[model samples]
Target: MSDIEMIRAARARIAGNLRRTPLLSAPALDAIAGRRVLLKAECLQVTGSFKARGGWSAVSAIAPEVRARGVIAFSSGNHAQGVAHAAREHGVPAVILMPQDAPKAKIDGTRALGAEVVLFDRERDDRDAMGAALAEERGLTLIKPFDDALVVAGQGTLGLELAEQANEHGVTSAEVLVCCGGGGLSSGVALALEAEAPGLRVRTCEPEGFDDVARSLAAGEIRRNDRLSGSICDAIVTPQPGNLTFPILRRLCGPGLAVSEDEVLRAMALAFRHLRVVIEPGGAVSLAAALFRPEALTGETAIAVATGGNVDAALYARALSTLE
Candidate 1:
């Protein structure tokens, strides 16, 4: 179990660097969900995503000697930028392995933060194995995107902020919908909510067909996705949940919800038009579930964490055109 102390330490360590993203209220979203809807706009966070929280936590916690050799990480987009930005802040070199087809915006963003970018063929290459080998060869510390304790703890800081903000609004019992990839964010939030607001329910939302966490929780075992590169929600398309994160999620989170790509596009369009936020498909899944899956939500207060805003302009325009 993840203790609140770990999250407290993580918060303290990364507080100065990370943006304390606001909890925003949207009347249009509330009307669609038939509930009081609040958005944890993590899209507005540093690196345009919440992954920076974990990246800073992990990198800063490294032993000074190890950090001197620098760090390496594997991510689709958001985590790449997170690690790169964190490494830059620590004055360390970072090598990031990303999918060759990952959104151009994310790749450019990571490079702009001064990390060396290595592109891999997503369909043919094993990112984990490649990242491990590269780390070993360079004698660099590997930042396991979700599996590391420090990373999970860092991600949990979002939960701390959300819980406190929700309580400030007089929300006693609410349901938090999180976008699930390797269960890092979902499980981290679950652990924090468990300690901060026991009354709140944590639910995960994933892209359909990539809903490994949902099936794993249902079967009480770790599950793997059948394919790796099918979804538009590329940010959350991990083969399976992290070993460390799954247990926390299984114990603390409610049943998972899966949304289709079409639903995700619709949600992204709605976000652009009403919220004035540019949301990637992966980041829109939780909001999609909140808008479309009312039965899974537990309370009148539905708070969805919009995880990223790294969509390419062409893709964003195409998705918006679907609204017509």
Candidate 2:
């Protein structure tokens, strides 16, 4: 649904508001992957994830009068913080509907950013229904986490940066692995690369049981995950790929890749130990696939997007202990 032009405009609109996260590599990582590995360190981006790009893009694109009326979104954690932060910066009110079971750090972080937090049960409550009710009551604009055009356009900016950075590193051709949930980030990046760096292809990465995008890609249609709450990689879990995002992914992306929970923890540990960057489980899936599923990759080089670093302290400590 998002074109390169919209992505470029998003980059322009969100300029100076988000970090141009770097592409990092460590010899240790390369050794594990058995190929040249480049990690797009989006974990270091504002709000500790790449979600800020879409948040800013969606919120800023709202008409000033409408924006002042406020904005609302539903996210487990990363997207909540992103939307909350953007709303705070624009002096607008934000109400975020977050899963009651989301990491405490994310809920607290969203509140710290000045958004009103509403908690809902992931399984029983329909977040979409709740959000719509709230939006109507408060006159709040809904900024969908991944399904909206502007949000997808905003996420596409990451692909633009990746294209430029890959060129700088002499990586004209490589598989760019992205941690995917409802396909927003992956689809956006796929579109951007299709236009800017046709040689750099995108591959959707997910935790094993929740490989909806991967299954959908293989099936040539959207597929829904049977369950949503079990994976430690909660940040990237969703019911299915976005209707808007799946077509782009099916059109442009390579086969989807899935990694186990153990692989995800190990990838997080490896990221901290080797890259000196902290990565949450959901954010580490791309790196997990690159490191542990090398046989599934076709390219001589791999670029994995480390999407977030919002892990709870205890969970982080547990991940680090795995290496010990």
Candidate 3:
């Protein structure tokens, strides 16, 4: 089977594990974007993020012997908790490698799910390298956060839910918005929508500091950002777009837009006030594009992926304190 086929198969195998999260129109955002807006509330998903979809998909795909060895993963936060939660359900142990600078709430949340957490430095070493080494040393099945095909397909299931939700709610031809990191969630989602709901235009939103996906698409090659600065959207600190994911995004998604730290923080507060959902800065960036970059998406219905609810309470409070 092709990569897309494999992804589809993975989705089929893991269909029983995920939630069909709500996709609802935000009347408030309609007034802001000047277009009807919908939010896919994946933050309310099982692991408090959309990462659970990919985690469970990859976990359940393993053969009995492979799964018997247990699993290990590396994530900034969301995927760590995702692996922990999925492994718990599958009766296996999960180990997660996270950057030392990751939010305390994310560290605590991953640990709370009973996964062993190991902290490292993004400046010194990559999580993929560290995770691969650990997985090899311990003979554990490794699940990548955003680069694996199974993981990508699993993340695509969110699109399945969105399409179903859109049909159910009588909203079609809307834009499906996702916050871009390594491109796992959006790639999978775009593919799913392409296959299932061709009318939907899948789009990506990212922090200005970590705009590799958008930049790479423009340059037609992978471009790395040597310095990442001023992003409240910490979950989206990817230095470069994944090779497999970049091509997918290039072909499957429409023009990806970026926003500032101020924009993301403001959007985060807006979601909290209007949707009554806790969206981390990264997740809120998609909505930020919808709100602040409305001219880029005029006349089209928009949907923002509320990718995760996991926020650093201290950070959130700080952001809120500065609100005007």
Candidate that scores best on lDDT: 2
Candidate 3 stretches with Cα past 4 Å from truth are 1-8, 126-129, 228-230, 322-324
Best by TM-score: 2
| Candidate 1 C-alpha lDDT tens digits along 209-311 | 9999999989999999999887889899998999999999888988989999998999999888888888899999999999988877777888889999999
RMSD of 3: 1.9
lDDT of 1 at 51: 96
What is the alpha-carbon lDDT for the whole of candidate 2?
0.95
Tens digits of per-residue lDDT, candidate 2, 1-324, equal 699999999999999989999999999999999999999999999999999999999999999999999999999999999999999999999999999989998999999999999999998998889999999999999999999999999999999999999999999999999999998899999999999999999999999999999999999998999998988898999999999999999999999999999899999999999989999999999999999999999878999999999999999988888897
TM-scores, all models, native as reference: 0.97, 0.99, 0.94
CA deviation > 4 Å runs, candidate 2: none
Instruction: Provide the overall lDDT of each model, using Cα atoms, as 2-decimal numbers.
Output: 0.90, 0.95, 0.83
Which residue window of length 10 is worst by lDDT in model 2? Answer: 315-324
